[model samples]
Target: MLRATSRLPAGPSGSRGHSRPGRRLRRAVVVTAVWSALVVVAAPGSADADPGLRLSNAAHLAPGVRYETFSVTASHGTAHGHLLTVDLDDARMKIELLRPGTSGAVTGIRAPVSRLADARGAVAAVNGDFFDITEVEHPGVRPTGSTVGPAVADGRPLKAAVPDGQRYGPALVPGATDEDVLGIGADGAARLDRLRLRGAVVTPSGTWELAGFNQYALPVDGIGAYTSAWGPASRARASCGTNDVRAAACGTDPYEVTVHHGRVTSASATLGEGVVPRGSVVLVGREAGARALRRLRIGDPVHVRHRLRATGSVPLAFAIGGYPVLRGGVPLDGLDETAAATRTAAGFSGQGRRLYLLALDSGAEHDDGLTLGELARLLRALGADGAVDLDGGGSSTLVTRPPGAAYSTVRNHPSGVPERPVPNGIGVISSA
Candidate 1:
């Protein structure tokens, strides 16, 4: 019995039916007070941060499980690094994982709270749900919300139940609720990822490896996962309302691998009109990850990797391609020096396409633990066709765009707190 005292997040003021569970826990209010578990309030205002993060800057995060506000900073404003993870420092918060009696405790100061903890209590404690994920470069603040429940706004509920549908893959966009399995791909091979997606494309567009992928749901999709109407690769090949069954192999998405000796040619993203650098990629087509199946989506988990090279075009820009192309296109600049060794990054490849799936060292967070620089190297070395980083540290979210989870979508994991529902998810839908 760790008797810790921390300020509480006042529940909904005088609302009806304040269930027993909703009475005790904090409701994720933006309370900037000191919340501790084994201690008292330490540094206040650390929890509340401007959503739009300042690049290369440092943000002193919350009072950890104890007396510590972990420091997180960017590197010279340049998105570069290999290791990526959320720092808990010693957070102190009550965990409500299998506690049936604690359901209505914190009736959502902002939104209702969900649990995946290992403790049971009536007090307010603090701790973190740190996760290993990919941190790519985008424009501004990290994307939020992808919880699981009733509608909230741009956020998702931390809990909701899908009717358990068919087969599928990550390729849905939702606010904070509806766990959306964003069907974004990499430029290369075996690229793990951690990110929150926009509700634009069932398989939205971007580049780079989705670094850390630790969130798993029931059976994302039975066979539909591979042939689901709007799966990962389906949208890539499904030109318009038609599944490029020929190009996509099976039919749905979640990329499938038909063995022509257990291997086929990987796809490529040619340079379009732009000042793409010799190694700086500029465009990544839809069918980038369409054909490569052997090493990708089979029955278990798969990692899609990609890169941004300025080597493709004259002015240097980003283009999508695999390892075979990676080794042949750009020279090694990071760790591996041998040209042929660079080919080692290309785990699998053939004619027009190449695939690379190098095993990254998985540690406490099951992550390569890379910084931006390391990430870039991994992308190139691994043969990423195109890749983009997602929200990392603590904000990497994955959600569905809603028709609801009856469709089966899974987002990020170990979320700090669940989110309310929202509208307009940054989705990756296909006209096909």
Candidate 2:
């Protein structure tokens, strides 16, 4: 719900006024009028106040879905771009967070947006989040985000939220950065929120802290398992094996883990194949984490406290970690003043009833991209109540599949040599 804050006048018995019925009524009327005006001013400002960007190539791809290309000329530079707007009017349709390969396979690295969308049968999609793109020898060392941030798809956490004291980038709160977040509820309503994730292994003996989920862990360190809900569903590959026990390798220290349902089922030094079995969880890592699991026996009470929490409940959430360019129709501070490059962004309507996706392609040499402030103004002009930056430059991409189309198509030009594979993506799903 939208709320407005305003200061009310002093009580009826003010120093300058008497506490009479007529005077009190007049004062109340004035106060009410002033409060209402303040709210209106706080609401989304006028569209005419936007930048010089002009919209063209506007077309409706499906009910509640539309795409439009735009361009703008500014003192800093010129920009050419496109945006996909989605109105949550269709009750049967939904939005999802797209990772590489199958929904829960824990192996394969990065793929194109087209492939991720087609593999997931999405109606529309875009590159999502910043990731660790450096190449590594380990198969698990694929290009996953340095911090995938908090993501929940279909009520399951594909990636864990940001832990305490580890927050990076600009945000309104310590955990909730300026990196704008998009959350879709089961009711098909879209909400914008700032959130973080925390996890631990809870057992009858005691609770042990977790660093993260589905990522690399240090030797003699602590790490959790990957359920079928997490795509790329494979166990961390241990370097050595003694009997059936996974032995540590990769120049890192060695650790072992035991996975089971409500108790110890199987222990391994290396990750296992296929999805985590139903009604089961895996414990992998070393040191205190390993010690904690070793103490548990069959039928011992164990639970994985891995879930995403928000100010409100949302079955789905994905992150785009760019500084907030706009808030409540006003431009934010710290937008780059000099450098201008191709950009990507996401935003919400004034009432939070609509969502917007934007990607600015590299145009003429002089027509670079939009400054953060300029981008915010453009979104405000386009009716965005709040907006945040997405991975831009070469990583910025926009893709969509028409309602009857069999596959998704890239709608904008990528600045990367060809097209760079991203760690994860945000996609639209047709529940119909």
Candidate 3:
């Protein structure tokens, strides 16, 4: 058995802080876990593993942050992973989205995880949501490089989920939707929740429902709202495909209406590109929705209101795209047990007081990666009560700044030679 320990600082009264609410405070507390090796027998659709799982090189990055690496012997071959354990109860610890630019931009360009961590001054991070990486179906259209699901940062909604059929990652586990997300709530606890887009565009003619917010694809015949958070990506991709068929031909009738300061400023038949100014919204529509937007004339009054309605009582402070893989300490049924591949995942335990970020290594060296089933099992064994799978494969990456390190460095062997540039990642910030 292997034991890893994390030390908690004392509270204002000089007593050790409690890990959860309603718990008694102690003079000191040592958080320890036993990660023993387990051997699994090969099954039809299960990962076979040797008794080699173990955590090593564990280090406390800050008062409430810890980092470690581990290796496992699997059916295909050997695999390795990097892990970050964060205690949300610590006042100096924070989790935020690590996007490309430092100007609060949510999406547009992709960058290496290390660069993103440095830009955000994060102590540790892992790759985030699946995104639109290619645009082969729509010739001449640039991929928007936007995440597949909703994004909320600093308690503000940045984007909403794309259509389930338009998602770019593997098939979601049973009962999971594109709206599923892993986020930290306003109460300072991490949990898995779903965020639905609640929005409307009211015009003199009629009020139209808004189905998307800064997403790469919109449902067929749907209208989407885009703002400055979308950066400079062209809105054309939003109208290029059908909701059920991602590769369908571009819509013949596409319309765009620009609303600034609550009034229509411009309208166009072809989608345009440029940074949307603050207090401005660009509405893109196709087919039936397009016809409705075309009726709006310049200088007409327009009212746009949108919010990401959380399914839970607690409001989310930070959230990113992902699908649930584990719940209530049990791996979800129907998870892919075979077909191992490098992956990224996040989980929470201790009633959301603790969050775990994990990224698997990929390449010729650590070739055998964890299947979705194995990934869930691994997280459960690591003490995760709930977990969500983030983007993986070439996009899988983990970066960290060890003690005395001048800058954060990529820890895992990313499948790509030069780490794959990604839309965003979950960053661990340590104020201490």
- The candidate maximizing lDDT is 3
**Candidate 1 vs. true structure, TM-score:** 0.19
Q: How do the residues 1-432 of candidate 3 rate in per-residue lDDT, one tens digit apiece?
A: 000122112111100100333222121122223222222446544433234577788878767787888876655666789988888888888899888975566557889999989888899999999999999988998988899999999999999998777788888776888999998999999998999998888888777788778888877767789899999788888887666667778888879999999999999999988789999999997766777788789999999889999999999999998978988887788988678889999999849988999999877777789878778877877778899999999899998987778788888874347889999999999777
Best first by lDDT, ranked: 3, 2, 1
> Model 1, residue 392: what's the lDDT?
34
Pitting candidate 1 against candidate 2, the one with the higher TM-score is: 2
Q: Give each model a TM-score.
A: 0.19, 0.69, 0.89
Candidates' lDDT values, in order? Answer: 0.20, 0.55, 0.81
Q: Which stretches of candidate 2 lie over 4 Å from their true place?
A: 1-51, 105-107, 135-147, 162-180, 215-225, 230-256, 265-279, 285-301, 313-324, 363-367, 402-406, 414-417, 430-432
**Whose TM-score is greatest here?**
3
lDDT of 1 at 97: 20
Cα lDDT of model 2 by residue, 281-327, tens digit: 66664434444555567567777776555656655444433456777
What TM-score does candidate 2 get on C-alpha atoms?
0.69
Model 3 TM = 0.89
lDDT of 1 by residue, 371-426 (tens): 43333334333234332222233222232222222231222233444432221121
Ten-residue segment with the worst summed lDDT in candidate 1? Answer: 222-231
